[model samples]
Target: MIQTRVFPGWRVVAGAFVCMLTGYAVAYSFAAFFGPLEAEFGAQRGETSLVFSIAAFLYFLLGLPAGLVGDRVGPRPVVTGGLLIVALGLVIAAHASTLWQVYLGYSLGVGLGVGFSYVPSVTAVQHWFVRRRGTASGLAVAGIGVGTLIGAPLANALIARIGWRDTYLVLAALTVLGAGVAGLLIRRGPHFYGLEPDGEAAAAGKASPSSSGFTLAQAVRTGPFWAVYTAALLMSFGLFTPFVHLVPYVRDIGLGSGFGVLLITLLGVGSTVGRFLFASITPWLGRRLSFALMLIGAGVMLVVWSLSTSATALVFFALLFGAFYGGFVAIAPSLAADYFGGRALGAVIGALYSGVAFGALLGSPAAGYAYDFFGSYAGAILAGALLCFIAFTIMVLAPEPARWLTRRARSP
Candidate 1:
């Protein structure tokens, strides 16, 4: 009888994908919930938006500690704990009677919860695969795009049928069910199962080389680290601004509510395609070049988006921009792994990803404030394009860490 073997790493990838998809779907559904929250609370755009910014800030900011915890204790516990906390946060938000309650329950709770799980999932995928790390990471993170694709329309439909509160309850249930299953399946690298990463026969011989690289302390001091960190921060500014504001902007520009939700879906579809497309070509173009080109593409698309006034123009912009944006996201984890070693990837990636926190803090509310002050999204959109261009420039010019370059030079 012939036996067929299933690689455990693929299971890890599947788990990460489910966790990311469900977590982001529930988290980003805030866009669909935005109008309802405002109507119920009688708050302005900027004020109501504080909840999401605070949540995202906590999510990205706390990812460092969460990653550290995952590094020390393992991913299973971290993901499980996060899933539970997210569920509780949603339940609390559903029952909240005051804006402060919403902030406390949803923003802080969900923020910390998601922070715990996000990096661990990404890091796990990196640990599981080497040659195909970009593809695996891209597949896992593509969940974010898929979540947005399904989540936006689902939330809108739920809001129309049942109330926003009930919609959140449904989301909470789904998040728990989906992520809990993932938590059970996710684990560290092949070492835990007494196998090698990628399950290759020669992986044992090359293991030491793969694990060699800067520790967290040493990595932080490198120029490449700062360059990537700053570029990620800048990228986040443009990336998240649209996630928070696009639906509202579409509405403001006279697209009906239904079309607004569909636009979000369109962006999701574009992003999904981009993530897969970019990741697939990373081996050919190299992560650095792939990321730089995608960043530039996104920046150009954002500029085009700003000129959009009609639904047709906006649709074109969404698909193009979303594809580029997704490509950028798909590359980040693999890029970090390339620049730094995979040994301390959890900590390094977490710290690098904190740029998302800072950028989200600035971008979302800034767009809201721009609208309130200027009565349009033009200025905010233009500013995001500029930031994306700046990020593209930084990524293109930055060299690999000197230590990494030296290591590569010394390698036979």
Candidate 2:
């Protein structure tokens, strides 16, 4: 037997880091392609946005099913499969000559791959960590920002030098490499290793699986589920707006190409720091409170973005904004797990992301069309800020899981 005893917990956390690199970097980086893709495919700007929205729709829509598959098939194959599909999507995007072809390959194929890949990796992290859950989740998902940071600048550079198609051929190779390493390195951790849920000999203690878990049906029927999902929906709607457009928006305001690239990348830097900060702070504040605070912080940043005229101010804005947005990503799954059980955590988390899908549906095209409509990003910024406030409210009002879990633990 391949023993989970073969390695320490931190190693598994390391594996999660690699897994996210491929998923977030390549899968979500399609936003950077908007300008090139519109030109290369001879499509309208909105048509390009449609490609991202559809992919996002598939990303969210496919989460629960993929989670179910992760549970049964085990995360290994699902993750490896996702990486392979991402590579395939890249190759297909490289060869496509029409808008529909790009949509079919990129939106459908890569998007679906994200659905398959992301949760397995995330769930694996959750499965592994119990006491330091927030930190583990943060480190693992932080790859989303790091990979995104790498991909955007690299994609931009490649687009300038090699053209988008050939550039994708190179990225496809990297995608394959990323998946292979994950498959090789990430064996199921403590559970597979025959250790207890928490490490058996840790400084603190050990844990068993929660005796409580809601059936998928039961989870879907609740007020908390809808509230968290709604908040996430607004998050995706507005969050990716920055990921997809900050660079272009910077340019639109006369910062020029290089600064625009720096601005976009800066958001990623903020995201990285934000993830670490949330991981550090969540223990003190609790997951629900931390999430609410992040939402509020992000919403305020959106307002700042809407009104900025100077690059110096904008850069600072990108930093703080990136941090909190990154924090949201790291904490989200743990919050889901805290409220729900890991039993349906994947499915529920995936379902929650469907809001993100809806957000993607609206955010990308709306931003593009806003640019198309008013010749500035102001409309998009205002809309995102308003939605962020809505997300904050949803999160604030959503039921706290600790309340229920504490009651369950103490009663009888």
Candidate 3:
């Protein structure tokens, strides 16, 4: 009788999941803190929104270096170190005496920390599974949804009871404890253990090839790379506006603060469902089409959001938008892997994400400023919808990678 060992790659996926959940929970929790921080510092809406924007920009931008470093050094040290930085950032923000100090601590500290942690952790999972790549990637990033689901309301409740300053202290402690333990579960790819991807056994004295895909330089030269990058850039311009502004938008319309938080929570619920739901269908729908649909769906939902005024309409918009947004996040890494292959995948994914960094840097803050100028979020919301449609058009026009096309042709 032959005995089969449990695949160890799932453990890596679990670790990545926890890391994403912890990091993004802290990141998205910025919404819950927004009003309090404004009150504390006497800052305007645009200024307060900048804090989230700067942090989002840094983390995504930093993903490039972090991914490069992870490619060379492996993920464990990089992820663990990043989490520590997150804890430190939270701690610094807890004791901040001024708005700039919050920026220094939260924006830079959290940004750098999440940047170091997110890409490495996510990219590590790509090297472990081929057959279930979509599922694994979705499961891994679903943490973002779960974190958002929990983070906003938790922060709101905590702030109500313990106040905002001490809430940061509490969040700092949780980051160190939760993400730290999960990071320990991360290891190198299956090749490092004398095995093949998807838990297949290697022949005696042979390990899976780790150098099977495009090098970073080669990947950058390809048309598919630029297409994906440009599409991601356009999609992101409106992608994160809701995360930073949705709560305030609800409140501005006379819905209570609690209702605003509830909308965010519902968004999270929709996001988690979308990740799992879309990933489950990708093998049948094809990555390109599935991803394009996510963009279009999100665009349509944003249009609905822009028009929403009543609580019921807003609630309906939140769930669907979250679904599409979550699907976009879940599918992106796998799509990159399909296009570029796994060689230097961390760096490849990171470079692709740089598009998102620039868009996010401008998007959320611009939305806030638009609101300030117009005294309504309608213009910014509609603009976000337009960007999403443009992104979808780009994706639809972009050709599939030759390698991916060949693979599909060869398949039954």
**Candidate models: Cα lDDT each:** 0.82, 0.78, 0.88
Q: Tens-digit lDDT track for model 3 on 1-412? A: 1134668888899999999899999998898999999999999889999999999999999888999999999999999899889999999999999999999999998899999999999999999988889999999999999998999999999999999999999999999986677778788888777777888877776535455788889889977788888888888888888889988998888997789889888888989999999988887878887898898898899889888889999899989888898899899999988887788899999999988999889999999888888888888878878888888898888776555558646999
Q: Which prediction has the highest TM-score against the true structure? A: 3
Q: Which stretches of candidate 1 lie over 4 Å from their true place?
A: 1-4, 202-210, 400-404, 407-412
By lDDT, the candidates rank as 3, 1, 2
- Sliding window of 10 residues with minimal summed lDDT for model 1: 201-210
lDDT over C-alpha atoms for residue 121 of model 1:
86
- Candidate 2 positional error at 228, Å: 0.8
What's the lDDT for residue 292 in model 3?
A: 88
- Candidate 3 wrong stretches, greater than 4 Å: 1-4, 204-209, 402-412
The C-alpha stretches of model 2 lying farther than 4 A from their native spots are 1-8, 201-207, 210-212, 408-412
Best-to-worst ranking by TM-score: 3, 1, 2
> How well does each candidate superpose onto the true structure, as a TM-score?
0.95, 0.92, 0.96
